[model samples]
Target: NYLWINHGWMGKKVKYKEEKFKITAIDGGWSKWSPWSICGKDCTHTKTRTCDEPAPSYGGRHCSGKDTIVTNCTGGLCEN
Candidate 1:
């Protein structure tokens, strides 16, 4: 409990605590995509990339659509 008086004027005193925090924003970077995988069942090929190039850090944004990608290859007929 406290009070402040200035020029015969009285006012209630307020208490406050100060806080400090640091935040660094980093955008994700991607590495080169690996070579296409050999055709597998259904003649499908897969390729993938990683964020290790500069992986997201300290609440940084992740690379958009960083998921694995599967593509169809020619002459890859699935044999029952």
Candidate 2:
């Protein structure tokens, strides 16, 4: 199967890989990495996680890289 990065905030949707994954979102400059949520509706300025690795136990395992992962700008954006 073919897969490509899907950007929901940009309304860019495409067919995804068959493998299971978890999607997350970050601001524009943070695209290459993950942003930490300092609080509800707020995020920390310190950049810790990168797109190349899983997030630090935010709760459970989340998709980090191209492992069938898609990036979205909202929590309810991607279907999985």
Candidate 3:
């Protein structure tokens, strides 16, 4: 649940400053309302998925085979 304290959707491109937010949990799968995942470099692995297993970059919960999970796609690889 996010609180849009101040609405900046209509602002100009230069006025916009992107902020990093983490996806605490997933609601089954990534539909339109999938929470943003941005928890440092360490991603919280689900119970079914082992810690040794690498998380997929752009994949849903029921993903199979080798997947690529980009950890910091939201705010870039390095924090500025």
Candidate 4:
């Protein structure tokens, strides 16, 4: 919880530098990634995650980076 109190000044204008209250920005967060799709046919698989874990709001920036990844599999070297 945050507490803020302002005193005095019934008819006065305060500059930005004089203001004591501040608004903090929030950053976005991502949820756990889904299991990689069974590497099949094309020997390729995919995994994904979303930013809904903590969707950006209140002037916050959206999560950066890709939400999905595609990986290529190989013989005798398939992902465990």
Best by TM-score: 1
TM-score per candidate, chains pooled: 0.59, 0.15, 0.16, 0.56
Worst 10 residues of 1 by lDDT: 1-10
lDDT of 4 by residue, 1-80 (tens): 43344546665544444447777777789999999887766778889999877888778888999999998876533554
By lDDT: ranked, best first:
4, 1, 2, 3
lDDT, model 4: 0.77
Task: Kindly provide the TM-score of model 2 when superposed on the true structure, using C-alpha atoms.
Answer: 0.15
| Sort order, TM-score high to low | 1, 4, 3, 2
lDDT of 3 by residue, 1-80 (tens): 33344447955334344678875532232222224444443433211222223333333254343333443343433343
Please, what is the whole-model Cα lDDT of each candidate in the order they appear? Answer: 0.74, 0.42, 0.37, 0.77
lDDT string, candidate 2, 1-80, tens digits? 76877787898877777776775453222135345333322221233434334343434444434422232333432233
* Candidate 4, number of clashes: 0
Which lDDT value does model 3 have at 49?
A: 29
Query: Over all chains combined, what TM-score does candidate 3 have?
Result: 0.16
Root-mean-square deviation (CA) per prediction:
9.0, 22.5, 21.7, 9.3
